[model samples]
Target: MNNNKSISVQNLTKKFGNFTAVNAISFEVEKGEIFGFLGANGAGKTTAMKMLIGISKPTSGEAKVAGFDVYKDTEKIKKNIGYMSQKFALYDDLTVRENARFYGGIYGLSKKQIKKKTNEFITELGIADIADNLVGSLPLGWKQKLAFSVSLIHEPKVVFLDEPTGGVDPITRRQFWEMIYKQADNGTTIFVTTHYMDEAEYCDRVSIMVEGKIEALDTPENLRKQYGVDSMNAVFLKLARG
Candidate 1:
């Protein structure tokens, strides 16, 4: 693993029985960069992310995240990275504070550390009123934000978000992006997968997956220029149609 790269994948492939989900895709994410992974449904984005994070082993090729081999050092990789899914996988039965404690504990945080971090998050998010409330009872936006905080509670070096803003309103999405920016500013590399074209523009660089392959990878500005299109939506349309 290179000292500079936070996440690296080389010819990564995944297969489900007869179908190839991710076919020989390769990419790299640098330290502290917000890298977007964008693709339509069944476009192999999730498959690739699973391989990088080490939960789903690649059928072929190699990957390293946070300087550890994906296949051999999955546990170590898990410790060095945080993952948030599209479903916001926190306990609905648990209160805001309780959920934070649960995740922090699993990540090997000490009791005192969990308490300190929980308090800091509650204050920083200005959600003290809901700290004791069940996560299921809170608004969707609040729950989404809380899920993000829980994922980062242990201060992992890299964070992977799978459509973290799936159903939230535009206003909530903006707030979520702000939090993402803050984490990146603090030296946390963000790897995100989203279907929203506008959200792709926020990434430092984006990779578009289609048919289990990375069809395009570039900054939003450069992609538009290369494709002679006005927006990422148009660029995707052109590529998907071809």
Candidate 2:
């Protein structure tokens, strides 16, 4: 296991009954790198992420996340990682401050730490005025940003984002990416799954899964050149069609 790598997997596989969701796939994510996990629906992206995040157990092969073995150290993995699903997992009824406190408690943060962090986060995001408002009343983009902040309350080593920018306007998406870039700059490895090809361009490296297998893995520029395409959309179309 390389100490500098945040995630390492070799021939990692998962099956449901007789169907193999993720075939023998191998990959490594370096510390602070923005790794893009791309694939069409049912292409095994979700299944693979579940295994890496320590929620879904693999049927065979070896894998490690945040330097902990997936088979034995799932609890540790969960503690050292943050996850923001596509659904924007925030309590709609809770106020911004309450949500922060809720997640902080779950991550075993001290009350003083939670208060300090919450103040910093709200001030940083410029949401201090609405800290007491119900989350359901905030705009979608604000909620998305808030959820992301909550995910980082414990300062996890890695953050997994599942289509995090879905349904947001172009400006909101760009703003979200800026936040992602800031996190990566601070040494948090970001492993994200997305269907948006345009977003793929922002990744340091991307792996495209086709039919439960990683058919292509490389930087966006290299992939475009290798496939003789002008954009990631075309690159994905060319590979997914085959």
State the RMSD for candidate 2: 0.6
Q: Among all windows of ten consecutive residues in candidate 2, which has the lowest summed lDDT? A: 165-174
* 135-178 per-residue lDDT for model 2 (tens digits): 99999999999999999999999999999988888998898999
Q: Where does model 2 exceed 4 Å of error?
A: none
Summarize candidate 1's per-residue lDDT along 62-85 as a digit string, tens digits: 889999998999999999999999
TM-score of 1: 0.98
Model 1 gets an lDDT of 0.93
Q: What C-alpha lDDT, on a 0 to 100 scale, does residue 18 get in candidate 1? A: 97
Model 1 alpha-carbon drift over 4 Å, by segment:
none
> Relative to the true structure, how large is the alpha-carbon lDDT of every model?
0.93, 0.96
Give residue 52's error in model 1 in angstroms. Answer: 1.5
RMSD of each: 0.9, 0.6
**Pairs that clash in candidate 1:** none
